[model samples]
Target: MTRVCFELRIKPELLDEYVARHSPVWPEMLAEIAAAGRRNYSLFVAEGGRLIGYYETDDDTAAQAYLTASPIAARWEAEMSRFFVGLEARPDEAATPLTEIFHLADQLAAASTTSAEGDAL
Candidate 1:
């Protein structure tokens, strides 16, 4: 699975409303996300309105394409766009993935492989 992360800024004045809106995302929107192949999704917000989102998918391209074509996703994004700052496109479509610098699980797996190799030597 590919882990994806993105950053966006929410309007400071609308941050509370944004969080409240997500407290219970629409059921159809949630189902559309699942149908698009995204899982383990989460969103984090900071005091300054910085928003970070993360999700994992087997194929990011396909997942994105699926969501781009989904009517539920379209409605959700349209409703959500107002809360975001400086986005010319829908929030979902505007999400540019953040680079992953580190992952503990990957490093641990590498360490295990190196140790096993040393044991054989």
Candidate 2:
């Protein structure tokens, strides 16, 4: 599965409301996300209006296409559009995939090797 991560900023004043809106996501929306092949979906927010989202999917483009075509997606996007900034399109369509610069597993392996060498010394 391809892991996808994306980010956007919310309006500072609406951060709490934005979080509240997501607290109880509509059941249909969750169903649609599953149907679109998005697995392990999650969203995180920080104090400075930063929102990060991640998901695992076999095909990012196809998953996004499925989301864009859903009627529930249209309604959800319309409702959510007001709370964000710097969106290229609707929230559903505006995700810009982030390029991963590093991964923790590789660092952990390096650390283990260094520790092993030190033990041999």
Candidate 3:
């Protein structure tokens, strides 16, 4: 699975309402996300309304396409657009993924391979 992480900033004054809105995302929206092949999705908000989001998908492009074509997702994004800052496009479309620097599982798997090679040597 591809792990996707993205960052966006919310208007600090609207942070509370933003959080409240997500307390229970629309059921149709949630269903659409799962149908888009995104799993383990989560969002985090830091001080000053910095928002970080993460999710795993088997095919990021396909997932994005599915969500983009979904009417439910469109409605959700339209409502959420007001809480963001400096985004010219819909929030979902504007969520440029952050580059991944490290992952513990990958490093551990590499270490195991090296150790096994040494044992065979």
Q: Which candidate is the best by lDDT?
A: 3
RMSD of 2: 3.6
Index of the highest-TM-score prediction:
3
Which scores better on lDDT, 1 or 3? 3
Candidate 3 overall Cα lDDT vs. reference?
0.96
Candidate 3 residues lying further than 4 Å off, grouped into runs, are none
For every candidate, C-alpha RMSD to the true structure in Å? 0.6, 3.6, 0.5
Total backbone collisions, model 2: 0
lDDT (0 to 1) per candidate: 0.95, 0.90, 0.96
What's the true lDDT of residue 24 in model 3? 96
How well does candidate 2 score on lDDT at residue 54? 90
Model 1: per-residue Cα lDDT over 1-121, one tens digit each:
8999999999999999999999999999999999999999999999989999999999999999999999899999999999998999999989767999999999999999999999999
- Screening candidate 3 with a backbone cut-off below 3 angstroms (N, C-alpha, C), the clashing residue pairs are none
lDDT of 2 by residue, 41-118 (tens): 999999889989999899988998999999998899989999998876898788666887787987899999999999
Candidate 1 structure, TM-score to reference: 0.98
Report RMSD for candidate 3.
0.5
Count: clashes, candidate 3: 0
Residue pairs clashing in model 2 are none
lDDT of 1 at 1: 89
lDDT of 3 by residue, 14-113 (tens): 9999999998999999999999999999999999999999999999999999999999999999999999999999999997689999999999999999
Lowest lDDT 10-mer window, candidate 2?
Answer: 88-97
Candidate 2 global CA lDDT score: 0.90
TM-score of each: 0.98, 0.83, 0.98
